[model samples]
Target: MKTIYALLGASLLSACSVPLIQPNATQAVASHYGTSAPQGGAALDVNWWSRMGDAQLTQLLALARTNSPDLRSAAASVMAARAQSGQTGANLYPSLTGSASATISDSPTTPRSDSNTALVDSKWELDIFGKVQNAAKADTARAGAEELAYAGSYVSLAAEVADGYVGYRACRLAQAEYQNALASQQDTVTATGSLVDAGLSASADLSLARANVANAEISVTNQRADCKVAAQSLARIVGVSQSEIDAVISKGGGLPKTKPFQVASVPADMLRQRPDVLEAEKRFAAALLDMKVAEAQLFPSLTLNGSITASDPRSWSFGPALSLPILDGGASRAGVRLANANALTAAESYRAATLTAVSEVEGALTRLAAARSNLASAQSLVANYQAYFDTVDRDWKVGAASLLDREEARRQLQSARITRISQSEAVLVQWIALYKAIGGGWVAPKVVISKDLAPKKIEG
Candidate 1:
């Protein structure tokens, strides 16, 4: 017993003697987003899609939140990770098991005999070298990473729904413009036919006018088809019926107008909002803990086991079991090397994710700025063309302009209107991209281990 006590004391001392080889790498990032916008504006809302002020869009996003298969899978992954963490944590505490058995025997030489026994057994591993503790911490960190991944899925789903709605609305707006152009062309064709019948215009002019009307009609038909396809695509994302999607979007709302929100000026501050970046960091932290577990494996392990049996007379036994690495070749050392290499890889991955997060934010900011500028120019172009078309139409009615000139002016006006519509949607799509690039205002959850073994987030 004294020798066992001496071995336990030596094992405890050796636990502290294991050398730690933790290698954590920090990455440098840009200071700003390369924008002049001031930092002080309304903070981004968690439900950023609501800022679009479109009820139909909000409804679609709500449906996607509840019905998206990606989210369901992510939620299941989080549950599995949490369960694994709890399982790992269980090793930190003592375990108890109970068993009962009964036997009856009849022999010619010894008459009849009956025996019954109930046994209680327990085992506790003493984590003197931090192996079990580090393993539990590693699994807990992995659980935290999975939770972040679920949040990432949530942000991605919202972005997808918002982008789909915007696409459908943009297609509808184009269809409307094409229909208006078709009506105008048909009227021109009717006027040209009258002139041809009066022998005042060439029949070739009438033929060209009829052809223009036919082309315009085809344009309208094609635009309508495109709009239907866009709506169907949206329906698939929101997991709703096509008729329901058509009913909601057919209410004739043009492109959604978004309420502007300011982005954080500092890149590091903004990166905190990104779930992928945080998830990568959590994985790195978990890898570091795993390396510690491997390092602890090089030391001795100590476990206490006890058992009690109730039979003809009650009996109990208790003892400490020490397992020293007498000769396992180099498996434990190889494990340590493998874990250290994984930790290094995780650190590099975290750095790469950080760089990607910053680049996405910067790219979104650049595109949004350019879209806003282009939309302004497109609006001016449409206004100027509309004025020219109106002047030409009045002159043609007064016999001061040819029908050909008025028709050309009208075509130019229609083209300008289409450009404006496309640019308008471009601006809105860029806004959605910006929102997603900034993580849609998802805050990193602070995981708090609760009594029920469920991962809970602490309220800020």
Candidate 2:
């Protein structure tokens, strides 16, 4: 009995020490971000879109969360992966099967016999080589990756819906700007006509004024069409009718001003917040486990089988079965090689994902800063141009400025207003991009990952 217990302990120790060949999971990141963006930002709210101060946007996002096909598909994938993990985990336990049969035999010049038999059969893979254990852990890691993928889908959906909403609102605001310009042009035509009647201006001036009015009318027509198209685009994103979008947006104002948010100072911290990055890490870990499982296959496997019977001569039997990979035609060796190559590939992929996440965040910060600066400049230009146009109009009324001067000033002021509105839209769009780049406030759920199962740097 002591000798048997010693052998069992030795087997268990060997099983627990399966060696893994893998790459380091950690990737180097920059200590500080570029782009002149402020450092040390606070944690972002999960419901970041609500800070945009647009109720219509909130409603649209809600609809998208419920109805987006991409999100539904991602959720289904999570469920499938979880089921597969559960199936793999079942291998760690013994399996039992029951069978029963009744037999009757009759022979000429002999006696007849009838018998009933029932038995329970059980089999268990002892996992002395750690093959089953590694495979189960690999599947569990795969399920974790799938869950992160689902969360990533949510982050992407929120950004898309918000981008669509911002686009539609910007279009409408531009349309309104053009409409106001059209009205102002009509007033110019009236004022120029009066001057022509009093012989204070040339008839050619009247022709120019009327032409300006016609051009303004054309702009308004095109802008209205563009706004309608924008609405259709938003409708497609949120899976709603164009009419419904129009109704909801009509209740609100111009482009939404998404409130400010911050990000973690450390690139690693920010990367941790991104689901896609974490998903890649999980996949890499799973690949390393797979390599371990394949390596374990190169060794021997032990399984125990037992059965009991109930009949005239009831009996029971039990024994151990061992499988060796002595002559597998290189199949097992090939599996190990393939798994190692895959682990290397997964490690590189994880590095690539980390780099991408960092680049996205950096680019977003830079673009947002530029957009905000441009918006401020555009606002100032609009204000100065408005004052200049007002003074020109007053000068023309007192006969101190010509009709041409007033018309030129009006054109400059209108152009400035258009620039301001376009910049406003740009600022909002950049904020949305930044929000997505920073993972939209997603945080990794607490999952206890085993160090032995995790990828680690291996010396060649």
Candidate 3:
């Protein structure tokens, strides 16, 4: 008993010093994005999409999270991976089984004979070299990676939902703009026709006015069609029927107000924020453990097997079993090579994902800044053109300006308004892109335990 206790204590002491295989390559990332802006200490929102202040958007996001088939599929994948991890964890513990049997024989000239046997057996593959331990940890890492995958899906879903909502709203606003222009152009056509009939305007001028009215009608038709498509897209994303989406959109007024864009940090923060990058890290970690498992297979293994029976003459046995690799040809060597290559692949994948994340953040930031600047300039231009149109309209009412001058000013004002609307939508799209680039508010796995990833004593 004393020797056993002493060995247990020694095992406990040495467990802390056990070594593990991990990703060896260092990740050197820049401190700031290429397009650095004003930095704040605010952390990214976990529910960033909801900050748009549109209640319907919030509701749609909630419904999509609950009802979307993509999320459901991802959830199922996580469950399956966790179940597999549990199965692998069983290798860390001893397995016990029992068997019972009864047999009887009878013949015409021989007396009947019966025998009964019952036995309880147990087998434990001692984790001296951490083969089972490494395998268990590898499975744990895989399960964690699957969880991260689910988070990535969630981020993508929310981004798409926001995009559809923004587009639908833009289309609605554009349709309104076209309707206003159509009203104005139709009035111009009526006034021009009256002037042509009175010999006050040329027939060519009246024809041009009619053409403008026709073009205005076509613009309204195209705008309405775009709105329908955007609505359908939102419906598909919400996993609801078109009618339901229509009802939801009917209550929606405009794009949710978002606080002006700011980031706490760039590349440094993205490494922790990006779900895909963290997922790649988990995969690489799992692959490294797999390589360790394969390397351990090259060594001998120790197992404890015990059996006891209850019968007329009771019997029991207990002993240690050892398995040594003998002549497996080149399979074991090839397995090691394969594992090594897979680990290398995982490492490269992680690196590539990191680089991609960096590039996306930089590009999104640049586009966002440009879009904002363009929208500001567009709004200013709209203001100036609208003032010019109002002045010409006043001048025409007093017969101080030609009807052609008023019409030209009106067209310029409408065109400027259209451009401003387009720039506004562009800014919103860029905002979504930036949100997605920053990892969509995903948190990495915090605390997880694999049965064992290092050499440890197996309980007897």
Candidate 4:
């Protein structure tokens, strides 16, 4: 009918008048991160720990990449998202289905007759309002998000390994200090006991010395236990058994001297490079496409349907099926509103994620700076205490000082060394934090928008 043709023409014109999803959705990122960052570095390396030149760390990171359950799950998620995107994309095209039936009938005076009927049904929606295309675009956006999420997971795993290893090595350093203190206390206890035997010292003094020895022993035991716990945690991260972890710890030799890394100059520079930021952006894009898809539902849909039957006399039917949804209890409008709300939420989330990334980098830089200062102070104190201990030893040799004075000086020196060791680990952990916040040099992949779903004029 001319009326039907005119209506179709009008629908096509209106549906093609505007794109369902604007191109700005994907690029609608925050202009800048609301904070500052350090400067003076090239882009971070993908294998960031390699810069530390620690062979053991590199090996452990490789092991984690191969065996981390979290990474495996993230990888699986990427695959699922990829498949879903592909499936949604396939829906935008026409499809044909083939079916066949066999039937037999018998009359009272005739033999049974049999025939086979085969039918082919072909159907496809024209997508005049970009409904299917927008849906596919949304799925593709989700796929991109999943891919970036995988990269984020990779960066996080490396940070976890670094955290565990740093703790383990720091524990070892503390344990060694505790052992030295324990030995020194034992010597004090022995010498004090001898003084008591010679009537030069009271039994109470010997008792106090022995008490110090006991306390030192307890500290040494606790420190060793803590080291073991840290080592076991590192082993779990490396996907190995505790004994294997012990081996790695042995291979570590001792607490490492970590190299400080400079952060990106601007917050946006780092946030844009971060995989989580990209993931959030993709999610926002997907949400915007979802809103477009929902709004597209408010328009009429044109479908082409065709069928053919295989028989003694073949038959076929082909026609256009128009679906004009006049009213469905305002569900379409509600759906569009819900989708818009979700898009708004996703946009906010993207902004928040970017801000959080900036905070992480800034916080780590601040902590690292403080740790460096504290370590410098501790090193200075250690040197000064060692000098004092040397003077005390010389005085004690000439009978100008008691053994207790020399012991006190030695304890001060060891305490400073212990403090330096702890600060060293803090600095290393901060570097790891910064590395993770900036996505550890992961190159984010380009977002793959479905070509079929991209905004285009409807071909009516």
lDDT of each: 0.83, 0.81, 0.79, 0.76
User: lDDT: which is higher, 2 or 3?
Assistant: 2
Clashes in candidate 3: how many?
0
For TM-score, the strongest prediction is 1
Candidate 4: which stretches are off by over 4 Å? 1-43, 103-110, 311-313, 392-410, 445-460
Rank the candidate models, highest TM-score first: 1, 4, 3, 2
For model 3, how does the per-residue alpha-carbon lDDT over 1-460 read when each residue is reduced to its tens digit?
6865565554444333323334454567888777865454245666566566788888888777766778777777777788899999998999999899999999999999998888889999999888899999999999989878877887898889988888888788878989999999899888878877988777887778888889899999998999999989888888888998888889967656654546656587767888888899999999999987887776667899998896633588999976665446656656767788888889989988888888888898899889989999999999999999999988875657777898799889888988888889888888788878887766654322223211111222
Give Cα distance to truth, residue 272, candidate 4, Å. 1.9
The reply for model 1, stretches above 4 Å from the true place, is: 1-22, 38-41, 104-113, 395-405, 445-459
In candidate 1, position 428 carries an lDDT of 85
Q: Candidate 1 local accuracy as lDDT?
A: 0.83
How close is every model to the real structure, measured as TM-score? 0.88, 0.83, 0.84, 0.85
Candidate 2 colliding pairs: none
Ranking of models by lDDT: 1, 2, 3, 4
RMSD of each candidate? Answer: 3.9, 7.3, 7.9, 6.5
Candidate 4 lDDT, 216-255, residue by residue in tens: 8898999998988887778777676777666656785565
Candidate 2 Cα RMSD after full superposition onto the native fold (Å) = 7.3
Ten-residue stretch with the least lDDT total in model 1: 447-456
